[model samples]
Target: MTTSTTRQPIHTSPINLTFLGTASAQPSSTRNHSALTLRLGSDAWLFDCGEATQHQIQKSAVKMGRIEKIFITHTHGDHIFGLLPLMAACLNGAGGTVDGADDPRTQVNLNDSPMEIYGPLGTRAYIRNGLIYTHTLLGRPYVVHELRFPGDPQDGDFTHLPPHRSESPNGRNIPLKTDLNDTGTWRNIYSDNVLSVSAAPILHSVPCVGYVVNEASVPGKIDPTKYIPDIKRTKTPMSVMRRLQEGEDVELSDGTVLSGPPRRPGRKIVVLGDTYDPSPVASLAQGADLLVHEATNAHLPGIDPATKETDTYESVQERAISRGHSTPQMAGKFATLIDAKKLILNHFSARYPGDDDVNEEARKIMEGIRDMASFEYDGPVLCARDLMSEDVVLQQDNR
Candidate 1:
């Protein structure tokens, strides 16, 4: 139940991911469900808010007010049961007035801005019904955006669509579509000055998507030695130093020109929902710094007599595929195909006794991935647990 308020690293380049819940369909004694928070800069983005997610958040250090955007992978109860409750809590703290003014512990300012929720077609209706049934009056306005592919030929390419703004049924202004480019791979779903999010359709029981959050590349660190040969002797004006730090070329009075350093690539993290097929995920998460994928089962390809008393490995895999879920081995192979730097497997089946069993199962999957792939992958394979937080560092190419 450790909070992430002070756990994030001091470095701003790397984003921090906190696993609020890691169980799949069923809740376990240790794991709650599927929910994760990505802290970038001062804001936080949530992926897949599951049952009792608000409780999980309360036990952790993530601020409800900092969650500006929520991206639900699908309509499954395990992935979205906490959406309405969390929204309500954000507007009005657990013990506060509707406007959150009565609660002394409420951290979020009620007048800041409305939270934007993005999901599949039924997202808007789902939120509406939840509010109606619960008699929840939103103290502040909230917007629910449903993702849709345009039918027109010109707008067919999801990557080229412009940001579409429209009013929601609740009279909130919501952006229908986000800014995109002509990548023809994944569709850009949202973007701001700091981060850009993209999504790709993946095969699943319901309309599901995997999101990619790419932090915008930042200016590289300035090499003072390259610009200022003699630090103690060089008497540069304060304005010239400021210009150089801002990545601008500066000319001194003596006609010396110093060029700015190149930009450094930002970090990329991919969070996917339930899916049997991993091809779309691999494409969207190519070379991602971190890949957070669901490992709902530990099914192997062939039948294993050891597990035949209850279910064979082959039978378990069959069920997983039939139900549109991924086994740990499948998730590992997908991460290998995409060459992800690190693979954090979560959404574990409640059948696993504890983290030890989960890690052992993941190890077997990683071994399989190494054997199948041509290149050997020695990257870290983390078995995600509830409340486990990890820093997603940018892998700088020093070579």
Candidate 2:
């Protein structure tokens, strides 16, 4: 009897999402403001850095240094007030020195890896002006990339005030796709070997944007037991085996063919800022593993026992839309339109405190919001709270 050799499959880290804050324009005693972190392995990406975001980071498991990129939906104070402070802290080495004390690497290479910040048209002006007016100097270099839509101000048009003495403004402004009318998706804002991020213009009071993070699909695992015998029989090189594992079909001199398995799809996460409508992102965000949408207002009866007044869903929804926000049902409708696997309602109003554990009324209100969203979408719904963490599961293929 011959023994079949088996090889170990490569392991990839799961993407974990942590909500640093889940408040709307006004923050309550429990919820801080709008901020969240998506952690993949050792690195993290921050979305919408609201007020007290750096302080919230201190309370969570996410490290400041690991946040390589920051994405802002708009320039609202509640969504961007924490950016300068966070950058300043990073420059101060609050997370730690770029290189370890005993490590041979030097900090001179810090400029090579500047932190990346992405946002709407005003992002560049906001950061640059903030840095200049506040006199907050970042020790390390940082870059800001603005996403401008059609009809926006052209470069050097003085619509966006230029920053003085800010060395990192590299004129890296990204514009909308010429075929946006047909595709409805913006240009891929950021991409690396592991992950790619894209954005779309959503309906808000200001120029707001929504982001979608897509992890690279990985090569499927191979059954070493089935291929090892053929490889040994045919005297095939180990390099051929590697090629087969990388989704390549290999043919040996003996006319034996080795076929690779199907690739495993990576997780997709859609996160939107304060927007009444986010349908523009549906094309890019379809079939997402997780959808994070704002639920700024909802009609929950008895939420305030003192008043004994119940606001109808239609009435509250009108108010939410007028303010360029979304209700729970509207968020659910968007999730359903995109066929999202899971939905998380965030950016709650201050009226509904997110202290589920400490306050029973708050917990009931949160549950009511989830229920309201569930009415439209059949997926699992979760009401976001401060410091809440969730792991996005990988989508597997049976083949």
- Going through the candidates in the order shown, the clash numbers are 1, 0
Poorly placed runs, candidate 2 (over 4 Å): 1-11, 93-111, 157-166, 180-182, 225-229, 235-242, 303-310
lDDT of 2 at 370: 89
Question: What are the per-residue Cα lDDT tens digits for candidate 1 across 1-399?
Answer: 001223222235557899999888899887797899998867788999999999999898788889978998898999999988898787652322245555443343344456778776666667766665555555455666565533222212122222211113332222234356433334556665556787776778987878888766666777676766632245775456556765777666566677777666677899988888857556667888898877677643442222446675578778888989877667777887888888887787776433444566644543443332213345677777778889987655611
Model 2's lDDT to the true fold? 0.80
Which window of ten consecutive residues has the lowest lDDT sum in model 1? 1-10
Give me the displacement of residue 227 in model 2, in angstroms: 2.8
Candidate 2 lDDT, 82-169, residue by residue in tens: 9888888876522223335443322324435578888877777777777666655455677777787787765642345555332355
lDDT of 1 at 365: 45
What is the lDDT of every predicted structure here?
A: 0.68, 0.80
Model 2 residue pairs with clashes: none
Query: What TM-score do all the candidates reach, one by one?
Result: 0.77, 0.87
